[model samples]
Target chain A: MPRADARANRAALLASAAQRFAIDGADVALEKIARDAGVSIATLYRHFPHREALVAATYAREIEDLAEVPDDGSGSVALARWLLRFVEFARTKRALGDLLHAPGADHPPARGVLLDALDRILTRGRADGTLRDDRDPADVLALLAGLWTLPDDDTWPVRADRLAGFVLDGLTTTR
Target chain B: MPRADARANRAALLASAAQRFAIDGADVALEKIARDAGVSIATLYRHFPHREALVAATYAREIEDLAEVPDDGSGSVALARWLLRFVEFARTKRALGDLLHAPGADHPPARGVLLDALDRILTRGRADGTLRDDRDPADVLALLAGLWTLPDDDTWPVRADRLAGFVLDGLTTTR
Candidate 1:
């Protein structure tokens, strides 16, 4: 297969996987994914062996598409702004964010990148006195996770932002 | 049955329901609850004819037990302490709390008393300038629900308290 064709095939597979996972959750079948992607079962199996692998790959693609920290001294403000974007990402993707974070699941290759990005933001906030220094980045992530736990509705973003503001204030220390 | 025997049966059933819900989530069988309570299946049916009735009863009982909020006049300090206690109730009950908050799930009869208690605390805090006057008490309950969203582990209470403090700070307008 040509390089372009292989890239297109992977892209189609991921797009369909994201759709299926969104509609039917992470238990979607590989064959169904291939059917939805307009690819053969052999093509699907060639691209990914199992459900966990497919979920990890699809989520990694989604994470990579998220906005990264701007290379400026805007500090914690930038971190808070980026977190609002992250909350939107969690809302639109629904349970996929939790699926990615679900423990004992197969390891994703990009987990380190995700955690490091979070660590960088919190570390910057602490240094700049915008966020409290008492908690770890993982706790920050867990607190932000409140978005995914919300009810699925049109008002999700509104409520999620309030929760985000609450978390941001929690991370910011007095004096 | 005598009134004394009937009340004893009710207490036993509620205790067993709480245990089963804490262990097996909201989907526990009524018959199992009856057996656990050492009562006849007919007795369980007589007490709670449906799943929602059983859940409402269990949640009401828990809320009643947790309504011992101190009337101490420390403003948001009092509110914060009460929220910490609420977090403990939610943490120990785990997913059962989620079931209560699920869409279309009816509030237990005692929910009014709990809400009133919380509203009084928030109202007092606002009067003392210790908490923000803008956010609704309903919103506060929804935000503090971040506790139930955390992982069920020994560290959960400590993590929950930290998150609660974050929310409390957000609710505070003073400094």
Candidate 2:
């Protein structure tokens, strides 16, 4: 295969691996994943040294890239919008969240980067009078944990949004 | 031993077993339980034929008697007080909750009776204009699941109460 083609294949494999792992859990076999990705097992192994590497890379890819935080909105509204997006992420990323929380799991790649992103959004919200100055990012994270407590029913999104709104209310004093 | 003394010893043994299981989980040994309760192993076995039986009895006993809900207050206030008490019960009776939730565990003893008691409280609140008329008890239980998501710090009770208030707000429709 051409060098560029191989790199593209590797990227495709990584993306597919993440989706499969998120949908089917950690025990999903590499053969099935490679097959689904339209690549061979040998190619999968060449790109990822092992299952953990693939899992970590997939998770790193799954986390939202923070370079897109809006620079031109009221901070509180932007923070609320950001938290709503995060709640959606937590609800849909259940499999990734489970992996990150599993006992004795390896650290996901670029965890610091993710935390830094969250910190930046929160700090900007506080500085701009959008978010309450008294709240910690950790507390906000803890409240967001409630998003994952959603039931598997038709009303899940509605209920999760309501709970997220409550959290937002608790975070801000003036709102 | 006298019959009354024998009954007292049996009661003490079960209480100790409940405390141990709640604090240490289901894996605690009978011998250790007997030692804690100052009872003989044979006596413990006489009262409870197996760990499952012991677990069941422990759960049943903890929930069999709850403090009476005051009839004089508005339904919402009454419901709030009742939920606080229930949350306290959950805090102290962690083992019962664990047994009920453990995968593949047998049906918990007297769950129907306990659930019925809870339903009555909610129904009374609804009838008396304390709780929202349309809220389902099942949804209340699901939302209460968020309580366990609280972080294990000294602030847990305070945070848990706030979460309960958030759910109560959703359950009510003041507007």
**DockQ winner:** 1
- Residues B104-167, candidate 2, lDDT per residue (tens digit)? 2233555445556557767877787666665555445545654554445577677667666666
Task: Write one digit per residue (lDDT tens) for candidate 1, span A76-140.
Answer: 67667877778867766764554544432243555555667778877887778876678776566
lDDT of 2 by residue, A55-168 (tens): 767766546553257767766676688777776766666555434332122334443355555577778878877666755554455445545545455776776776667667
- Pairs with backbone N, CA or C atoms under 3 Å apart (clashes), candidate 2: A76-A130, B75-B130, B76-B130
Candidate 1 chain A: 10-residue stretch with minimal lDDT: A98-107
Candidate 1 structure, TM-score to reference: 0.73
lDDT of 1 by residue, B21-63 (tens): 8888766778899999999999988888877677777777667
What C-alpha lDDT do the candidate models reach, one value each? 0.71, 0.65
TM-score of each predicted structure versus truth: 0.73, 0.58
The TM-scores, chain A only, for the candidates as listed are: 0.81, 0.72
> Model 2 — TM-score against the truth?
0.58
